[model samples]
Target: MDEIITRLQRIENLLEHLQAERVSKEFYSIAEVAQMVGRSEYTVREWCRHERVRGQKSRVGCGGTTEWRISHAELLRIQNEGPLPIAKRFG
Candidate 1:
């Protein structure tokens, strides 16, 4: 279908523009995701909150909050579905 083709093209453009940073077989931090998606760390966190990217917020020792851990699967999900809704662009 034309819609599917258009959607894939859009995803391809995003991936190319993002330098197509393929994720490794490990969890990634917000900063890493920001770099991969060419967005800001804040936006990545927002994506986690919005469920755009599946993330885990586990508490560290002494009740300290640990940074979100994103899996490669989430990145693939974004690649298939689309990019996060970033309010501003980053370089």
Candidate 2:
């Protein structure tokens, strides 16, 4: 009984550590975020484009073009809560 409880506690600790390490990254690409959130890459990209989520365009290479990169904190927020509020655009 005591041994079983000890093993359970150890397992829980390991799980917690793994969870922390999972999001310890500074940023995540759209594909990675999509996999984590169980959504399509296109969907995630669209979210970035629509300003539904927080992200920034990062330079992928020496080229002038850039791609979206989401921060770890934003990813956590999206997982726990949801996307940010929709902003009303004024013409």
Tell me how many clashing residue pairs each candidate has.
Answer: 0, 0
Deviation in angstroms for 77 in model 2?
0.4
Candidate 2: pairs in clash = none
Give all TM-scores, in the order shown: 0.55, 0.69
Query: Residue 71 error for model 2, in Å?
Result: 0.2
lDDT of 2 by residue, 13-86 (tens): 99999998865789999999999999999988988888888999988888778999999999999899877666
Q: What are the Cα lDDT values of the candidates?
A: 0.78, 0.89
Stretches of model 2 off by over 4 angstroms after superposition: 1-23
Model 1 residue 81 CA deviation (Å) reads: 2.5
Model 2 accuracy (lDDT, Cα): 0.89
Q: How many clashes does the backbone of model 1 have?
A: 0
